[model samples]
Target: MPGPPRSRVSCAKCGEGVNDRREVISVLEKKLCRPCAAGGYYEPI
Candidate 1:
């Protein structure tokens, strides 16, 4: 059987269009792409 449906969402940092099934990371309630998410751009303001 197939998994859940994938939703289209843009990366909160880079604004890249990606599917939910992709390797995305959520930080502070925001969805980010792998590159941006791993880039350590989440610096406290």
Candidate 2:
């Protein structure tokens, strides 16, 4: 099945499109996918 189109802005960590997804991670004032912000290894804040 085809996903909901593709967008330019994607999550830096996850690589998923941050297009239609409302609940995106706005890190550094930028947009990111849910998984990118929530999952993955952590370094520091």
Candidate 3:
């Protein structure tokens, strides 16, 4: 068996991989990552 091909969507702000499909695109900027969009400045991982 195989899995679906990964979709490549770069972060609007950082130009990095979002890693997941964002159902709704942010309008403040372009496509922003979860953290960027959420404004999570320093959330402990």
Candidate 4:
């Protein structure tokens, strides 16, 4: 048997789609991704 379906969540700040529930951050009743929650800073690659 298969498990329940996974719900897709998006970040309120950057509107980025978050695939994993563990990576979602809830702030002020809004869902935010890791980068957005961390002030949206992307390190140079």
Best by TM-score: 4
lDDT per residue, candidate 2, 1-45, as tens digits? 267645457666557665655446564776777666676566558
Arrange candidates by lDDT, descending: 1, 4, 3, 2
lDDT of 1 by residue, 1-45 (tens): 267546777888879877655746675878887778777656659
Q: Is candidate 3 or candidate 4 better by lDDT?
A: 4
TM-score of each: 0.55, 0.41, 0.56, 0.58
lDDT over C-alpha atoms for residue 4 of model 4:
55
Looking at model 4, how many pairs of residues clash?
Answer: 0
Candidate 4, 1-45: lDDT as tens digits? 267537668788877887648355565778888887776566768
Model 2 residue 31 CA deviation (Å) reads 0.6
Q: Could you give the candidate ranking by TM-score, starting with the highest?
A: 4, 3, 1, 2
Each candidate's lDDT (Cα)?
0.72, 0.61, 0.67, 0.70
Instruction: Tell me which of candidates 2 and 4 scores higher on TM-score.
Output: 4
Off by over 4 Å in 3: 1-5, 41-45
Identify the leading candidate in terms of lDDT.
1
User: Which residues of candidate 2, in runs, are more than 4 Å off?
Assistant: 1-8, 40-45
Residue 30 in model 2: lDDT = 62
Each candidate's number of clashing pairs is 0, 0, 0, 0
